[model samples]
Target chain A: MDRNEPLDRVKNRRDSALRALVSGVPYMTWLGVQFDRRGDELTAVLPFDQKLIGNPVLPAIHGGVTAAFLEMTAIVELSWSTMWEDLESGRISPDADVPDSLPRLPKTIDFTIDYLLSGLPRDVYARGRVVRSGRRYASVHVEAWQDNRSKLIAQATAHFLMPRG
Target chain B: MMVGADDAGRDEQARIAQQFIGAIPHARALGMQVEDIGAGKATISMPWAPHLVGDPRRNVIHGGVVSALMDTCCGAAVMAHPERPRSTATIDLRIDYMRAANPGQGITARAECYHITRSVAFLRAVAMDEDGEGPVASATGTFTVER
Candidate 1:
């Protein structure tokens, strides 16, 4: 079997696993999150929902909701990135029979969010980058924006406990 | 401050705090309830729900849910403060997850606005499930007070 064949197969399985993981979380599903992947980068879209608004006076999305969105994005991005790395390094076999379970979900150790601007009542987009990943830990940076990516509504940094394969 | 004016101010602040919580759609979605509020302090609770679970294998609530709870509690604490502004926005928040919240248990968050300046309020909060001694998470945050 070609080495690339297993990698390709694992990638296909990962997509289905990611979908299951997102649909399993009630809040994420309710947020109407849609994922777009380009290479190693992942973007999460949170469609506008009236129920997400925090301040009716300002008509702004809740800060807590924004934080949660960014945190989830980082976690998902990190999880997928790690899986890719594992496949490349032979840490996980492409033929492993664990079809019903995803790789161990990363546990959040700490997270910091900075609210740069009030989130408007529109679709919000978040992108996550894994700053560093090790056997036991991963650090991710994420930003949420509406209207314009340069004018981010919020930015966050988080550390997660990665599972050693 | 006159005693009568002080009491009235407190009452009005309390009303505003309640209204603020009620107006938040996300809080409503999470079933977050304001349990108590005092000058510079607030307590909020979230009932356990199946949808909030992050790891089904372990039956643990998602960490993001805990972060949202702490953030909301901290905001409420700022609003209940005697020196609270007419409005405020979260400037930043840092949360440390000590452990996963126990499954099938309601979580409560208690927060205090420890300091205030002309333009900012500083707050600290802790979230626990049943056990007040062992916290599921802790947070520190700052909010911008609109003058």
Candidate 2:
């Protein structure tokens, strides 16, 4: 059901839909996480906050906060991908109202993260790749970096139980 | 077990745990309080807050908050170990979410450093809500122990 609207209008709608979905989660808002959406893809941004410091000696970002950032990125990415499919099939309408139209994200079943380097006290960026998404389950691999994409601060693999359609 | 536990050792453990918690800003922001600490074991609790809610419709606490609590507890356990590791950092952590934490009830995490080598300590932790029969989540992690 690709409506005969201008291409740019449809693209704008998709982008806004993605942002609304991320903002619907209160914890995400509290963490000050923002999404950079281009078309349907996204890169999550976490701004530096003094209150996020875990080790006062090292002045490093809390490992737990990093995990939370990665996990949220994965869930939001998965939700956006599912919504894209639904949009193509006309299963749902473009979200005119924000929170009510936001999709319910999957619940994490398990997450394993390896810290390659200490999370420096700086703004961090993360992206999630959906390894596999099926009717009942999904798996994602996420990477977080500070200055460069090649130099990763942390990476993780997570499995989630998808919400029923 | 009580006969072998010395009063001085217990006092040192509790003091170390408090110091570690006090130094962390996120732990304080979340209002986490250390309940007890004894050689290689630490228990911490956090009160429920509206900002911590993840599933707004169901009013469930966020999974990230649970992981953060467990991570802090595990690190405290390592720092308060009888071996007296001067510093520690999480190298790898694996968390399994067993159930959603009920909102309004507080969450507490207990962690134990079950094993230690020269440079690494192994820890496990469980996060429980006030009314849950079983744990809400469990985590196992490895931390670098700097003597």
Best by lDDT: 2
> After best superposition, candidate 2 residue B123: deviation in angstroms?
0.9
Among the numbered candidates, top TM-score falls to 2
TM-score of 1: 0.88
**lDDT tens digits, residue span A67-113, model 2:** 88998989888888888977656566546365567677799999999
Docking quality of model 1: it rates as medium
Worst 10 residues of 2 chain B by lDDT: B1-10
Cα deviation of A113, candidate 1, in Å? 0.3
lDDT of 1 by residue, B1-147 (tens): 011124556555555555667777888888888777778788889998877777767677778888888888887787677774666778999999998877678899999999999999999999999756699999999998775
Question: Each candidate's lDDT (Cα)?
Answer: 0.80, 0.85
lDDT for each residue of candidate 2 in B1-147, tens digit (9 for 90 to 100):
111134566666566566667778988878888888877888899999888777887788788888788888898888778787878889999999998887677899999999999999999999999996899999999999987
Clashing pairs in 2: none
Which 10-residue window of candidate 2 chain A scores lowest in summed lDDT? A90-99
Clashes of each: 0, 0
Off by over 4 Å in 2: A1-4, A88-90, A94-98, B1-12
